[model samples]
Target: MNTRWMARSALAFVCCMAANAWADRPATQTERQAMGFDDPAQLVMVRDLPFPADSDTRAPDGAGLGDEWQTRIGTAFQGRTGAFNFGGQAPSIACTSGTERFATATFDLPAGAAIKYVDMFAYDNSSSEEMLVFLLSVCQGTGGADPPVSTILANSTTSGTPGDTVVTLNLSSAPVIVDRYTCRYMVRVNMASPGGTCVGGSIFLDKVRMQYTP
Candidate 1:
């Protein structure tokens, strides 16, 4: 009976140790693959990227009036399909003739976030005017006006004429690191000559996508 009890105790201890070992062990490669899990090293997630901009603030609602970025009105975003100009406008925002007009969308990111790249999916069919996008860091929107403290980070080409084109500001080589107080970014659509040909303006904007790491 004594020998039997000792054998049972040893087996129980071995079982307990095996359970404890696996409790803290990382999943094996085969197990991870069976669960359809991505590699942990490539587990980048989006934190500040806007979801509302997918389809926000249509042309009729005075969506972007005094200030372009309004959090109350559709998550502080604006889009253009070329209504007031050769590109588009935010209803109340000036889509004047002659001078170049811009349809810009703003983004607010956390301090430690990093900007990987921006993709502007656009269609540029206008030979008279142009529609090119730029990613920039501005000091306070118009607040950086007096001297215009602006830095042009990256820009896309204007050759997406008559078809679907994706212009990218890829910085995968070196992502733009940011801080809350020091960095504010925007995607500006340089729409040349607003209101001149409100009817049938050539360039059209499909969407703007920002890929980042937080």
Candidate 2:
């Protein structure tokens, strides 16, 4: 018997056994439903605001420690300006310097739409700074100091050493339900630093889309 032929025969037999094992695995109820999965079409795009270079507004130098920083959203959305701020000294704070700007926006999902996913693209435009962190918050209605229905999806500071450009964030792990009863959802981007001198620069956000998988 040829040694090469014998070796080839053994490999073939092992591959067949592995395939058989995988085919015999049981499927869960959810898996069975997902087998015929067809994602839902997007119903509406309520607010699509771009965080360009001009979107950033400088705050007063050494302003109050706990002040609300906002970016004007023009008359397009009823003269609304997105609100953002640095967290207190306890956990973490937003942009450390005065020139840095944090931007936020709110959008209303359709009346009876189930929000399956949210896709975010952010550009960290800081040449000297190597890293920057941002936060995404989802809430029921748009108002003062309300808790988010889902947990806060905080993205670790991505390396800016490679140069500032758009980076997409996957929201499959943090899906929120937006049905007829739901009112509004908010997305906030802020500088993430515990206690350090904040360097001021610009970050761009674009191509933000939400899909409903009803």
- The residue ranges of model 2 lying beyond 4 angstroms of the native Cα positions read 1-101, 125-156, 180-183, 192-202
Best by lDDT: 1
Model 1: per-residue lDDT, tens digit, 28-86?
45433322224454222112222233443333432223212112111233434443333
Report model 1's TM-score to 2 decimal places. 0.49
Poorest stretch of ten by lDDT in candidate 1 = 66-75
Against the correct fold, how does model 2 do in TM-score? 0.38
Residue-level lDDT of model 2, residues 59-107, one tens digit each, is 3441223322222121111101233333223222334344333344555
**lDDT of prediction 2:** 0.37
Best by TM-score: 1
Candidate models: Cα lDDT each: 0.50, 0.37
Candidate 1 colliding pairs: 82-87
